[model samples]
Target chain A: MSVDLRSAFFYSRKDIFKNIKIFIIITLSIILATANIIVINGLIDGMIEDLVDNTVESSVGHLNIYPDNNERFIEGIGIKEQRLATLKEVEAYSPRISATGVLSNKELSVSSTILALDPDKERKTTKLLEKLVRGAAVNPNDKNAILVSSRLAEDLKLDVGDEATLAFENGIIKVYNVKGIIRTGNLDFDSSTVIMPMDEAYRQLAIDNMASIILVKLSDKSMSEIYKPMIMQNLDVNNIRTWEEETEFVSNFANSWRSISSIISGVGLIAAAISVGIVIYINIIHKKRQIGIMKAIGTSNAFIFTVFLMEAAIFGVIGVFIGDSVGYLAIKYFEANPFLDAISQTWISARFEPQLFYIATIFSFGVTILAGVYPAIKASRVEIIKAIWGT
Target chain B: MEIIKTSNLKKSYMLGNVEVKALNGVDTSIEQGEFVAIMGPSGCGKSTFLNLTGMLDTPTSGEIYLEGKDVTNMNSNMRAEYRLKYMGFVFQFFNLFNELTVMENVMFPMMLNKRSNYKERAKELLNLVGLGDRLNHLPSELSGGQQQRVTIARSLANDPKILLADEPTGNLDTASSIEIIELFRKLNQEQGQTIVMVTHSPEIGGMTDRIIHFRDGTIEH
Candidate 1:
């Protein structure tokens, strides 16, 4: 009464119901825009997360202790292991010896990086054991057993218990039976890589108690930066790198993807705003005569303006609610059946970030309200004579 | 006692860069409970006079007084307030909100006035217009005469001191026009309702207590 909010809401409700088809169409457009934003953003977030997880969990541990400049390999492994074992922040550590080698199965010869590791230690430090797709994990005591990536195994025509001759860069040759084939979903790691017992590597590479790098898995992966200095303070290593530094390429890619996502979302939201604005403007135009009649009968301009604005708010709330529901369902579906990224060779699931939902809701609702302003003002400013007579 | 008065009321506007004087230096007054008709030809400023006196438009020059209070200089919001408190308007087209039922349409003005008893009051007014049984009917569902009755009921929603109608029966057939005129006469006689209506038909104009002839934006006695 007297153009209060309740009366305005009453008018808006009746008007919307009277034009239910138009209301549904406008609301559906808003829903499309909002869901588009959520799904696209979720996929990008999932891709970035998948890339980071594979880099940190499958290969590069949270912290890697590498040989400092001018040094070929890290010496004093026993002392380093003892110091690393003393730290509570370190979950597990594996010392690895790497040598470029050629593996041939008589018919095919492929260049590969032979990584020698302690099977038990590598299991605790990396996801290598869990990612094994064929045969059993290499046993630490079995000197003749080796592991090969699924891609390399395919190239060399090797399988479980199949012997392949490996010739190291130093010309040391030996034949080892493949114990396992692993697919970590990292194309580089799966393409040209082999795993063998450390003892076998020591004999083949002619190295004594030296490691190319020590991969240290932290209890909390995110604490790599903070714990890197703490581990360095305790150990004698001068070159400790955090996972972020080791995965700079992935971080750069993620940043680029984020920028692209923002641009697309910006365009989408603006389109949504324009669509809402045009619909509201048309509604006002159709109601121009009624508005003038109301004014002629002593209804205040504020009342007419409030009624239209309330109509827009109703559209926004309903549209955004349906949009959020649709987006949540889509994200859940994608989580169950992940998207396979061919370029990265990873299966990425949509990540449900509550912040994304909140942002989309606010933008859509706020934009709809803003879109209502001009039309509402125009309705309030209608000249009674011209509007009534259509002059 | 005089309830409405206009002195030297002149209203001019630009019609595509050419000046159109809708009302020019007119003077008139309606006594309380007076049933008056403004009789004029097409473009004779009868509607303009009604619109200006009803506070629906501003005058280019002159003064309008309602119950001895000068209201010519009031701003749009003030005019709307005064109009809500004291004036009611009916248009040639009936102008009833098609979305609202007859009961809701009658209740709208009272609601705008923030009257708590709008429902009962609207029912009473609709019953007076012989439309009590049609309260739940939309204006589109009703015949033209019935819709006009609803408009009249709505015009009385706030119980304003004066009702100004521009060609209230202009679109009605002869029988519907007589019925509307009879309803107006009944309202004037029974409730002492003040009415100023514009009608071009001499037959309709002859029924009012008085007729003020208008021609070319000026009133003729």
Candidate 2:
């Protein structure tokens, strides 16, 4: 028959049902590859998002301002209130003085970070007040009271209301009662944090209101690029850093992870493409006689080629579509019930990326089209007489 | 008037550097509405000459005139176009698309053309070929004779100017062969359909208007 493209398309689709084995194999291959890509990419993105959130909430705020040149600590809000509030990006700011000190009882001593900050302002910037595992939040009224992480307290074997002496730099020493125990999701930070009233820390360090750092919290961290320059332009400070800058480890991990995902997904799909290619090759070769008959009957080469190519494309689309639907269900399931980090006490959910679907669809269709080229051409160029004679 | 005429028709093969002439410098003609049979031994170039005449293969050297038009030099695509528009073919093996039903197979030739009467015409042809009831049956589901009937039905789908059959009953038993040859004789006598066939059977050849016997690629009578 003189087959038109429309007839060939419908014929090829119906023929796919006739050859169910090859159809099933090609469909399953695309499904497996597509599902693997979506799930793996979701997991990776989920981990990165969790890391960024935890870092921002635990240690760094949206931005950080250290002292100017030739100095380590900045003495209070060197940038005036009118100047700070005028930027419009500053949602809230926490001023704190940090020092490395040793806390000891009669039996043990461990080095840790001591932060002296206003309890009210710190609560607005971080989750310290909300994440208290035992005892109350830090008290600004008690000059001799301090807060410690549950990990740090465990390390020193200290509890709330227990008296421990803290030794600071420049030979200053003081004894204080532990008032609260807090647990942050980060293991490293949890094991080394000690908090006290800002006035008491200045007295112990004898630094005269020279706060070590001021963390500037923004309404949106993503707008740091626009706000950072404005903040820098407003203040005479040179050492300000954003949360993304402070958490370089997370960014590096995310970048490395993306490359790995690409390699793994790329390899799987290419293998599938080659497999589908081989099947198409076999199909065309086996049907050489039929193709020859068609050619002799005046069926155009282009029409025959379009038939096979359309068949391959339909395989890719149908398979990827089914796989994507199943994968989306998986993504939503994971999103609703996140994996638990028992040690950090955190819940992390995967990020569902729609681009994964777009990329997978395009790649799958591309693979089949590319693979079908040689076989389609071979089918189109069948030697009519030899093939019809079965030679 | 001659519907097909060949002048100095030649076809050869280089089998391992040895030249084997399948058809060597033979000239022949068949008038329109004539039923002709070609008889030859194996390897006497009967099938080669049929292929050259049908444009199924290019001749090694010769000029072939179809309705007084020189078609020997036409390209493969043009030859295919000409053949599709004006000729029908029946093969020994039935060569029906095994996957298609009898009806679909019958409609295949006309399907190449955008004809609206394909279904009704195919049904009419199948009924005429005594396979009207087996329209939905695949070739594998039918007897060899029934399958040959389907190919014959398919051969008339395009309503072409000429019908070419190459050992149309080579795979059939005596009874089926007689029936098929009788159908060809009926077609030639009733409809004035020009028919050219190749066969080894003298009984079948005797039913035709003329039988051209070939020996060493030339007509003996």
All DockQ scores: 0.64, 0.48
TM-score of 2: 0.91
Candidate 2 backbone collisions, by pair:
A1-B112, A2-B112
How do all models score by TM-score?
Answer: 0.95, 0.91
| Per-model CA lDDT versus the true structure | 0.88, 0.83
lDDT for residue A256 in candidate 2, whole number 0-100: 100
**True-structure lDDT of candidate 2:** 0.83
Candidate 1's residue-wise lDDT over B121-182, tens digit each? Answer: 99999999999999899999999999999999998888888999899999999999999999
Tens digits of per-residue lDDT for model 2, B125-192 = 98888988988888889999999998888878887788999999899999999999999988888878
Instruction: Name model 1 segments beyond 4 Å from true.
Output: A1-3, A105-108, A336-347
Estimate, for each residue in A97-216, the C-alpha lDDT of model 1 and write its tens digit. 988999999979999999889989998998877888889988878888889998999998889989999889999888888898988888888999998888888887878879999999
